[model samples]
Target: MKTFRLMSQIHLWLGAAFGVQVMLWLISGLAMVLIPIESIRGEHLRSDEPTPAIDWADRALPLAEIIDGQSLTVLSARTGMLADTPVWRLETPAGPVMVDAIAGQSLTPVSEALATQIALSRQIGLGEIVSVTSLDSPPREAGLSVPAWRIEFAAGETTPPTTFYINSRTGELRAVRTAAWRIYDIFWGIHIMDWSSRENFNSWWIKVTSIIAILFGLTGVYLTVHRLWMMARRRKAERLGGGGS
Candidate 1:
């Protein structure tokens, strides 16, 4: 009985303190489920055009010349298209960079025209270009650490507005965001209790809430079983008393 009372107290306090949090979880989880995962990935908006092949073996410049006297310590390198041009994409301690494979010139900080072209040629969907703008800091939606070119596109009435982020320097496709994706992202952020940076699931707030949630679950289970047991005992006693009468 004492244990039952303690369980009741814990359950009530848990509901008082964290019921709202649990409700938010339910709402967000439902929202996420209602929105298809493919939509979140912006699959419908992705460009149907196949990517252009790189001219790597023959015409493209050699690795040494691409690095040359820049004193660059090439940590990683690969060949890919930059706009219509073949280029060497590199990862350095400083940051990621790109070089024209044939011309052997740096393509870092590609011009706005090039960024727009990149968005046009390699973008994922049939979106008409809406606006091309630069951001000093990446938007939370982009999920990037570097500044980027924000390209807005207007799709048909059936589809929501979509934005693509291209690395301002490397011109790499960074992330895709649409109305559904953005809403889903918000719900996801709330679901994880990391409204500030939706990507972080390991925050101290989450840890504390997790402990609270576990306690709530355990106490609620105990309270429920105890109630059922008491009801059963009451019915048994009533039957015995009636039989004696």
Candidate 2:
């Protein structure tokens, strides 16, 4: 009886000590299993359409200089549908922007809107989840042949992170929600958050908490087995003529 009581007390204390940590692990693990990181980020938006035509490679203005004010970073050029027509591709704060070299005209206004969506998606990552991407499917249209290139914005360490696709011909913006590259974002988010992002996984506190929780589980199991053995012995002794009626 005394041994049983001691073991029970140890089990109780271990459970109490590690209860919160165990609960956290359970909750976070369940969340990850049920929810996809992409659904959490946002939905994919895609559109395809032919852009208005321009003379092949004839617009003589400085395409790079025109987009300088829109937070343009990476800039490149390619030949358009027509011979000698230059298709200008640029990365900007909003997203990617495409311009016509021959006509010296902006192709589409995808940059501003795309940048806004991506920014909103990141902010949503901070627990401000809105189900904006719940549309059944992204509307699809015909493909254009001006010039085509894909751009990827850095999705900080998670699977299915927000990505942008730019059509150099029409300057269209398509948010890429699913692909092989998206898996990286999921893993990254999990690693960075350490299964508990609210407390910031980069802190020393979580490391200590995790270690303590593991110890609690191990100790609790040992105490349980010890109590079971003592109970079995006591019951056997009682039956072997000591308390046999």
Candidate 3:
């Protein structure tokens, strides 16, 4: 009985000591689960040069120039070919670009297309969520088809998430947005870090909080069991009339 009482006291004290932190953890966890931190923080609208007027040949050279210093390379170039619609395709080291086969005019700045893809992949608002991945690889078996260019690459064991689509002809970024994006953004913020995509789950703060929560729950269980056992024994004694004193 004394041991049970002691355990009860200890449990109470432990819970009281960590009560605030436990509440915070629950709130934070719920927020992490329900909202996308990315959406909550919101994304900054990037202002870039508007659409341009130029042909595929002129645009391709400059686009190649922009990616030149980078890891981009020209993979294939087929002229006078078109999609179901009249569109020309230019393959690059990074990805393929579709251009208006007939226009001889540049559709959009290469920098702008790349920039918009990068920007949309981020969570910008209080409940927004964005996912980004490099599509500089070959196609996978998923049903991912792009009119111009669709970035298809596998990150982790996850399927190739289409991060962005480009106006192959115009070099413009066209990303789809949804109402549920905010919830995903919040979840992303909770899961990821701000500065870089480094390992955030192994941090000391998370460790400490986890340990405290575990202790708190264990102590609560112990106290509840002790109380239930004591009540049962007391009832037994009453039924026995104090052991037939």
Candidate 4:
């Protein structure tokens, strides 16, 4: 009886204290599962648009010619795609920039017109283009820090519009943000109990809450077993009393 009372009190307080955390875990988990990962990643909406492969090893200008007289120190350089156009991506002290592989000419921070082309070439399956936004520095909301172009698609009849971030320098596809993905990201932040970064799952908040949840489960199990044991004792005593009488 004392054990039962203690278990009941612990269970009640645990629920009262950590109920919201439990609910957040449940809801966040459900939200993540309900949305298909492919859709959330905006992969389902992509067409198999074939980008130009790098074919400039022999015909293109040498690496030294590409980097000649540049002010900032070139960190890295590689042949890559800028939309359907093939180019050389160069990493520098300032930021990434592109060089025309054949011409050995600096071609980055691509203009808005080129950024739109990059978006259209990459995600041709999405909705009609509604707007284009460019920033010298990447937006805070963008998980990547590289300067990028934000291409927003028109909302569909049944679904919200999708947004794609294309790297201004290399014209690389940085991120695809669908409505489902945005919601999932929010729930993920709550699930991990990292309201600020939304990326740290090892936060102490979640750790403490997990410990509380475990204790809550153990107490509930004990209460169930204790109730069953008490009922059995009562039935056994009644049987003995009846036989004696």
Best by the lDDT measure: 1
Which candidate gets the maximum TM-score versus the true structure?
1
At residue 147, candidate 3 shows an lDDT of: 38
Q: Each candidate: RMSD to true structure?
A: 3.3, 12.8, 12.9, 3.3
lDDT of 3 at 28: 50
lDDT of 4 by residue, 131-213 (tens): 99887687645666767888898876655688988777766777788868878888889888998888787889988988898
Question: Which candidate do you rate higher for lDDT, 1 or 3?
Answer: 1
List the lowest-lDDT window of 10 residues for candidate 3: 153-162
Question: Which residues of candidate 4, in runs, are more than 4 Å off?
Answer: 1-3, 16-20, 47-59, 93-95, 136-141, 156-160, 221-245
For each candidate, the alpha-carbon lDDT, in order, equals: 0.81, 0.48, 0.46, 0.79
Q: Write the per-residue lDDT of candidate 2 for residues 1-245, one digit (tens) a residue.
A: 67656666766776776676566556656656565654543443222333435553345556556555344565554433211235565555555565655565565543444433433433322322223321122322112233333333444434333444434334344345444434444444444444333325666656766676676666677777876887998889888967666
Instruction: Give a tens-digit lDDT track for model 1, residues 140-239.
Output: 7886778889999888566677888888878877777887887888899999989877878899878988888899999988888888998999999999
Predicted structure 4, TM vs. truth: 0.79
lDDT string for model 3 (113-220, tens) is 443443344312212223333344313221134333543322323221233344443444454233344344444444442213223666665676567668778877
| TM-scores for every predicted model | 0.80, 0.39, 0.39, 0.79
Q: Which regions of candidate 2 are displaced past 4 Å? A: 1-10, 24-39, 44-100, 103-203, 239-245
The list of candidate 1 runs beyond 4 A from truth reads 1-10, 48-56, 69-71, 124-127, 221-245
Clashes of 2: 14
lDDT of 4 at 168: 73
Question: Cα RMSD (Å) between model 1 and the true structure?
Answer: 3.3
